[model samples]
Each structure stands twice: as structure tokens, then as C-alpha cells.
Target: MKKVCWPYFDPEFDSLSERIYGPTCRVCIDNESLEDCTVVKVDSLNKQGLLLEVVQVLTDMNLIISKGYISSDAGWFMDVFHVKDADGNKLADQRVINYIQQAIGTTRDPPKPKAYTTGKPLEPEPHSERTTIEMTGTDRPGLFSEISAALADLHCNVVEAHAWSHNARLACVAYISDQSTDTPIEDHHRLAAIEDRLTTVLRATTSSATAGGNCTNQQQREAKSGGGGGTMTNVERRLHQLMLSVRDFDRPLAMMEVASEEGGKASVLIESCREKGYSIVTVQCRDRPRLMFDTVCTLTDMQYVIFHASVDSHDGYAFQEYFIRHVDGCALNTEGEKERVVKCLEAAIERRVCEGVRLELSAKQRVGLLSDITRVLRENGLAVVRADVATHGGKAVNAFYVRDISGNDVDMEFVESMRREMGPIDLAVRNEKSLMPPNTADHQRPRFSISDILKSKIERFSHNFVAIK
Candidate 1:
């Protein structure tokens, strides 16, 4: 059986054991505590991947974590998060609060299995309105264009999609449906043909620089369920896992070393906390949404337990410090292991950073729309680096991050021409920038590294925890 990549972490706490022996998960939502953001405090019995669960729930709800303190050092977990809605205001909605309480609160029920029947012929997986197609392989110019054209040829309409490329690899999850029926594609033979065509496109060209060697059938089949039910899967998390599976982190040590101090790259420093038998990992990077989740998820998936951690952001830079040990309870004792952790964490953060100009298109939903748009982009010598496509109330809203085939800046004149050609479809360029360091020269204040205040923060919040060097 193929391993499940989504919901990468599974909690071991059963409802009966949780109540009796007591994980006693208590989630306290305090909107009164902070003026700028709501303070959410979670206390529970510590277990593997618990931090990720809390963060995942919050992120999935579209809550932004501005600051946080986490401690699970003494076999109990405590997390204090200062979070806000997308508009940068405290969570004020009663319905949202109630949902959070029910989700992570003490009386929360265990998650039910997410299985459903579509009652359709030749359904490989339970689905709803649309089928989801997930693909990953060596990234090359016009690759998405080819896939889009292929789907259009197969009479499939793309309703939503998201794609990410990193380290010469691409992973995409696209929600699609039948062009004629406007429903989930249920014909198994048809799905196999689509799958076969896409696989051929993926393997048509391979560059030696592509990570993970050659793209294989096993990699493609991991999440190829022919149903929109895959929408329930966390698209971003699945992309991270897919990239990780392809060994995106496995780069030449010399090349990896060069990235350690590069601009726009995450800087990771791993040290030992021998007294506590923990590895101290500190990451400093440009602040962005879900930064903490990416880091925590990577560590958890790598079999590391974060005993204590602090996440803070100021001046558009994020600072994270984690005291961690292996699942087997040993600190990173070798240089190679530490370097691997650094490279993996860096890859995780970089996975979601879109490259190039972002163009948002809003129009009435129609079959072959994506194919037409991608075809136009390819004709204009633009290559999609990343994209997000969705539909609401019969309106198709899509965002594509694209660059010139030669890796130059995208031309606005071509974009305008394409907009006119598409007719009535609202196409606008959205200024989407990657997480980049703030220009220090523009500000008079002296810049300080996370290390300058790391000691003070650790000393203040982690008195009960062991000291680190």
C-alpha cells in the first residue's frame, strides 16, 4: 500500500486513554488578553507531533500566528499563540471561537475517518463535484502548459489547482472534472489514460540537474486518486511531503554549504544541548505566513521531537528556536546529521516561495479555460513557476506566478495583450514577493541577529527546562 502523505502525522492518543490517563487537552481562547491579537493557550499531555496538530488546525482555519511559545519539556505540552485573522485583527467571531474550542478543546472528539462514497461507476476513490489530479516530476519550461493542454484534450476541466517548484522538481494538485458533465470523472479507463498521458509528459524531458534522479511511476501513483476527495487533503502539506519524498533536500554538501549564508535563504544553526540531551535548532528567515508550521512539520516528519520552542517575528524577519531530540531520545551527535537537518529545514521553507510575477485571473468557469490561459502564457514565452486556481459561485479565480523562459522579468505588455485576448476575464498583475530580508540600509536602527536576544527569551520562558550552551 502506498503511504499516505497528507495528514503526515497521526496522533496516538485515543479518546478513552486521553480522558483517563489524561492528555487533558485544554484550549483556552482569550480575546481579552491581547489588544492586537487573540491569545490562544493550549495545555495537554505532551506527545509526538502534538505541536504540529495544533499549528495545523490553526493554519487550516486561516489564522495567522504572529508570536508563540511552546514547551513540552516535562512530558506535558503548553503552547501560547498570539494569532489574528487574515485582516490582522483579533479573532472576534463567536462562531470561529466555538469551532476552535470544539476542535482542540478538552471535550473534543477524536477525528472520524474521512471516507465517503460517490455512488458512481469505476470510482477509484470517493469524490464529490470535481476530481483532483496530483503530479510531480522534473520541472522544465512549459511543463504545466503541456499538462494543461493534455487535460483539455482529455475533456477535463480544471476548477482549481496549485503547483510548487523547488530544486528542479515540481509538485501540483489540480482539482478537475469532466468537461461535458461538469462532475467528477468516474471512468477508470479514462483516468488511466489521463494518468498515462501525464506520466509521459513528465518523463518526456529530464535534466541531470533535477533532484531525486529520474521520476518513476511509484512517485506519480502515491496520490493519484481520481476524485475531488483529495481536496480534503492539505494541498500545501502534500506538496511538502512530495518534494521531500523526491529527496529535494539531497544536494551536494558543497552546494548546500553555499546556501547556508545566501540572501533570501533560511539560515539554520543547529547545536547541542548536552545537559538536556537535545539539539538546539535556530532558524532565522524572512517572516511569512505559516512559517512556524513549515518548520515544525519538517522536524516532526524527520523524527525529531521539539521539546521547547519559541517563535517570534519583528521587522519582517522570523526567528525560531527549537530544542529537539530524536524520536529515540538522542540529540544530533554527528555533523552529517546536523547538516542534513539544516538542508531539509531550508528546503521546507523554500518550497512555497513563488518565483516570478503573479497574475490573477477571474472569469466565469468554463472548460479548457486553463488550457487556453497556459497556452497563451507559453506562446508569450512565460513559464508558470507556481499557481493557485479555484472557483466560487461560477466564477473561476486563478493566480499564476510565471517568469520568462530564460528566467528574466515577465513583460507587462504581453500580460496586457493576453488580458485583452481573453476578453472580459479580469486579469490583473498582483505584486507577490517572496520572503526577502528587509533593506537594512533604509532604516537607521541597528540590525540584530536572533542570537542577541535568544538567551534572554529562553531564560525568561523556559526556567523549568535545562540550560543550553
Candidate 2:
């Protein structure tokens, strides 16, 4: 074995480390530096997973990252981002700027684990009226129907939810409350029963056509209640982590062939840098919000350390490059390993590109609301590819990206009829031209803001549904 000298052995390394990791953190915003977008410059320590953390914060705020330049190969981390709000305007709100600064600067110290002298963690305070359920299982048609039906049967009202499926694996997080009381269910037995019911529904498989093969493996059928087992901060990010944990990247041979055939314009290329002891991965695809966050989250969860990276978007296309290595400090040494990395990165990028029409719904909160909505979709031969469910005040504001059961484009005529049947005032279809595949051309992405949708729903909530808090 060859011996490698450690960089920290030099005494000067200590001073440099202290200076970079000092208590003071800086996040500068310069609107004058860019003609089209606001520029955000960050100088902080190169902490593990720091890149993903920053990207995640901006993404969750619904900010669009037009371009990014990252350099964190050493102790210091420095980066610049060109960002715009959802409406394609530079960030102008002082409150928003202050929030970004605080969020980026306050991550130096990770939250400490609770004291566990008795070998058990302290139970967190119960969420006032919402209980979140996290589940992972086989991906199949009508799976969401079954899960929502089960919850409805148990007298639970779905408040908010998100689900993702890829490579024949499904993961979902749902927030629910007592249907009658509108409060969180604290009974241990009831919670366990809910878990059992949902687990059974997820484990039931009707065919072998599921993309990755039969899902009889015990690891796939899992259901946990109590607010994602007490650590569910970001539902979408948790979905990524759950999918990675189950190795959803390992697609079946037939599925891989189909994906390759339908690869569209997205491409991933891996190149070796033997001289530098690093492997470079480049991804090219249509530009959209949260593109950088998705790739960075996948890399961090896969145990690959990104030493340096660059991101840019132009003419409706995105280009991202990463210099990465295994956490073991070794470059990819085999073709098989490289291929796996490529497949995983591709999966990460595609998982968020929902393939279907976008439907936005707003209604008064009530029991069996979710079940009824999903049942209608199932009856109309529509399958949900992505869903975001949320509630505010006393209204449910949700979005569903769906396709036909046969995996074809939905008929707009039929969708219009369905909307009419379901009350056109409550259910509306937005312009999803921007959500098209990367190969699509000449379609300008639309500006759809979740906050704006929520506000509109809340404003229209006649006195009947308003709750005086």
C-alpha cells in the first residue's frame, strides 16, 4: 500500500482552518452585479454536505437558481449564485434577503442530539393537529388509492401529502388529523393500526410488471407514523433519502433499456481524472427550478463527496459538472461503479420531472376529501405521478401531476369534462407547458408560485370555511 501524507500535519493548516471556520459567517447579496438576476455570494467553511444545504434552502423558498459557481475543494467554501424569484424578477424583498442570509449563516453548528442517559431519546411534543405518515413500498397503479382509502377508513383526514415513485419503488409522506376532532391522534394503538393498515396495502402486489420486478422483499414494505418517526423536516428531501435507502437506482434490465430508449435530451457523462485522483460527472438537461438541489442531494446521500462543481443554464438548457470521489477518498476504479453512479444521478434528475398534467385543487377541509379525490382520478383512468397536498386556515390547497393509466398523454377534453364534473370553480388545470420533457422545444416555462396559489385559495374561503384563530 502506498502511504499518503495528510494535509493537516502542517502547523499552518491549523491557522487557516480557524480562520475559515470562525464564528463569523458572511452572505452577500448584490443585485447591481447582474443584469438579469440577483447575485448571492457565500463565504463559509467547507462543511460536509454544505453545498446541498445551501441549495436546499434557496429551493425551498421557491427561488430559481439561474447560474451557480462552486469551489470547495479545500478547507474554505466559496460560491456565487444567480437567482430569480418565481416570476423571473430579481430578488427585491429585504425580508427575503435577510432570511436567506440567516438560513445560510446559521448552519455552522448542527443541532445536537438530545441527551439519552436512559438509552432512549426524549419524545418530542406532539404536533397540534397534524400527524405525518411515512411509507415506502412497491410502485403500482392504484397504490395511492389504496393508501388514501385506508386512511379514510380509519377516520383520518389528509391535510398535506407528497409521494414519489421511481424504478418500481414508492415513498410517500402524508400529514393527517383526526377526522372528527381535527386534532392529532395520540393513541399508540391507533397509530400502530394506521401503520399496519397502510403497510398491508403497500405490500399487496397484483402483478410482476412493476418496473424493477416483484417487490416481495421485506425491506420494501415499511410504514411509520408519528411525524415521520420524529425527524421529517422536509417531506420531499425525505422521499429522496428513502428512495436512495432502498437502492431505487438499480433498475431492471428491461426497464433500463426502456429508459435508454426514452432518454430524451437529458444525458450524463462520466470521465476519469486520474492525474487529480477525482472523477468528473457532467449532466445536461432542460433548465428548471431545483435542478441543482436534486443533483446535490443525490450525491450527498450516495456517500460521494463533491470537491468542486459548476452549474449554468442558457437557452432553456442546464449544464452541471461535479468533481467527486467516494467517501473512502478513492476515485471510481471500475466501469460497473461508474455506470452505477451515472444511473443514480440520472434517476435523481428525472424523479422530480413529473410526467403528466398539473391539477390544482382547493376546497374546504373535510374527512374523506383525499380519498374521494383519488377515487375520482382512479375512476377516470388517471394515475398520479406526483402530488403535493397542503392545508391553510381551513382550506385544502393541493396540486397533482397525473397521467393516464396506460402511461400516455391525458386527453384535455376528458380533463375538462372531469373538471366540470368535479366543480370547475374548485378544480382548475394550470399551464404545464414548462413541465414537459427536456426534449420539448419552443415552450416557455410558466411562473407558478405555491404561495400565490395558497393565498388565492385562502382569500376565496367564504365565511363558511374561515376559522377565527
Candidate 3:
């Protein structure tokens, strides 16, 4: 047959083998075994959610899959996946099957679109005729309300308003309409009056009046220093402090040297702070070490310093004099730094309460459930005392302790509304006496009187101690 070439039997058979396998499906090649490959169909409407759920389930099952595809009509999704056990066999597991079923069940129908007519006249812009006042400064609380109230007092209509803050600063945009612009009150004069009022209010409301005044004066000085471009005024400072207290992530550091018996209590505090998302710089344990005040001052980045003598009388007056002497630019004198530190600590405390609430409800099936409870609390203007989430038997168990939860002065209807929003949450009123225990020997120390110290000092210095609950 004229020396017929038999490629199968020839030495060049390797080239033929490569050609045969070159066009193999990516799904089949990646899995390396045909038996490992699985093709599953999912509902197209909820494909994204189903895919995410399936991916999470697969990750848990130690399975690997390649790219997926959607079919025509957008009603079906096809996923090619495989599982690798210790033995390397690619087979679907019970978990994968359950996940697929769950995904299918959870698939939702696509939302229907509403028809809209064209060629209709657009609605006129709201508040176009109103006088707009643009206020810019470091973000803080009550600024918007105060501005609105001031406008109201001036017989001005607050047509539109919005407030935003960043890095301990606030800016507000408000539109006001006055009956007559020809009156003695011009926009600039009105703004100046409002600014003055805000400064007075900030100084009055602050726990540290001197510090508040100093901060206001600093802003004024800065404005004047810049040749009157006008820095953030008093209202802005208050608003900024409030915003920082509520949102900033920086936390005060708490350092302690506890015995092995007290270690557990300290751990609880550390865990509480962690739950609240406050950063813990350090936790040390030692027996009768030298009083190192600078270490705390350096590590904590605290402008104000305070030291509490341990419960054991043996560790007395550890580094108090050193701290008073060495630490310069103390918050006691620097008003801005004091307020910033106070606001930071307040944020930390709030974070702790939030964490406690979350820990108490850790057994809940969904995080959204807890979020709903918090939303309700915020809507009703109720202060959350403590929230804890704990898990038992693979289910989230939650407990909410709130202040003024009895609904005496608050509307019962609103309380019921909040209860409804919580959706089967275990809400409870906090017992104040139980939460705050009586002072022990540690509380009676002759060191710096925490209560006697000015609120500014306490607020500034408290950042060094981490709150557990």
C-alpha cells in the first residue's frame, strides 16, 4: 500500500495526542477528571444571589468550579463545578446538593417595570425662590437644627436643607425664604448673628466651658489669621464634635496589670472593646514593675493622662509624678485637643454598647435582624444601654438593654412600632443598679480623684482605658 503511514503506531503519535486534547472544555480540564464535572441549572431571575450563596457553600465544601454561563431567554443559568476530596475525586457532596436546592428556592421573580409617558412638562424645581445660605466647617451635631431654628426666628422658611461632615468638620446647605429681603437684616448680617449665637451655645453646652471657648477662639483666630476667609465657627465646632463622637473609629487605650485571677475580667473588657471595633493598643501583665507613665502616654497618644492604682494596695502611686512632670501640652490647657479626645472616647463608649448588643444577639440567623433593632432604637430616640449576642446550638441569641424602655413618657404606639420593627428580638429594659456595681477597694484609692477631675480631663484621659461593656 505504498508504505502507508499509521499515525497511531508512529513515534510522532505525541503530536496527534496533543491535537486531540487541545480543544477540551475548560471545565473538564480544570477538574482533571470527567467524573468530577457537574452541570447544574439555576433560576435566571435571582442568578446573582444564587451564585453568591452557591459560591459560599462550595467554599465550605472544599469544591472548585470554573466559569458559568446563562442560556437564551435569561430564564436558566448553568454552572459547571467539581469537588475534590482528600482522594481527589470530583463528585457533588450533600452540602452542594442542599445549597443548589436552597438557591433555587430563594430565587425571586424579576421586578416589573412601570410605564412612563413622555412629553410631559417637568415639575418646577422646589425652593428655587428661597434664599440659600451655604455653611461650611468641621462637622458637628445640632448645627442644622440650630440654623433652621435661627431661620425660623427670622421669619425665614427653611425650604431645603442638608448637612455633611468629614475628619471632625461639618458643612450645611440651607435654603431660606424671607417675606421681605428689604428689611434691615441682610443675608451676611443674618449669618453673622447666627454664627455668634452658635458660638455662645457651644460654649454653654460644653462640659469644659473654657476648652469650648478656646476652641471657638481658635476658629476665630484661624479665620482672622487667614485674613478673614472665615474658618469654621462655634456651631460648626459643636456639630463637628458630635459627628466625631458618633462616627470616628479611634479609641482610648486602657492599660492594666492584673493578677491571673483578674485576667479573665480584663479579657472580657478587651473582648467588649473588640466587639465595638475600638482598637486596643496593648494589654500587659507583670508583678511590681517600675511605674512607667511615659509608656502609657507614648502608646496611647493621649494628651491628657490619668493613672488608677491597682486594687492591690501594694502597687501604690505608680508614675503619677512622672506623668505630671513629663507629659507636656496636656489637654487640661489645650482646648481643641481636649474636645477631640473627649469626642473620641464618647465614640468608643458608643461602639462598646453596640458591640455588647451585637454579642448578646450573636445567635441570630441574619445580621440584618440586629440592624433592624438598632434602626428602631435610633428612630425612637432611645439610648441603647447594652446589647449582647451569643451563639448556642448554632443559633443566634440576642439581648437588648436600653435606657427609658418603659415607654412612660414616650408614646406606647411608637414603642409598639419599634417592637414590630425588631421582628422577634428579645428586648429588655436595663436595670441601672445591676449594670453599675458598688465601688470596691480598687475604687477607694487615694490616687487622682477621677470624679474631682474636670470632665475635660476625664474625657481626654479615659481613652487610655478600654471599656468592656
Clashes of each: 0, 0, 33
C-alpha-based local distance difference test score of model 1: 0.74
Misplaced by over 4 Å in model 1 are 1-23, 106-128, 206-223, 226-233, 251-262, 407-409, 438-469
Clashing pairs in 2: none
Model 2 C-alpha lDDT per residue in residues 1-469, reported as the tens digit of each score: 9998866686666467457566445789998977789999998777788888888767756788988898887677899999988778888777677767777887546442221111223433233457878888877777888888999999998877888877777889887888888788789999999988998888787667444544566767788887422222355678888787667777767777865555354689999899999999999988887789889988888889888888999987899999999989999889998888887887788777774367777877677777777877877677776787777677777778776676544443454454555553366554344434555442343433322343344454442232111
Quote model 3's TM-score.
0.24
Order by lDDT, highest first: 1, 2, 3
Model 1 residue 107 CA deviation in Å: 6.7
Least accurate stretch of 10 residues (summed lDDT) in model 3? 222-231
Q: Which stretches of candidate 2 lie over 4 Å from their true place?
A: 1-24, 108-129, 210-214, 228-233, 252-257, 263-265, 407-425, 434-469
Judged by whole-model lDDT over C-alpha atoms, candidate 3 comes out at 0.33
Per-model TM-score, in order, reads: 0.80, 0.81, 0.24
Candidate 2 residue-pair clash tally: 0
Number of the candidate with higher lDDT, 2 or 3: 2
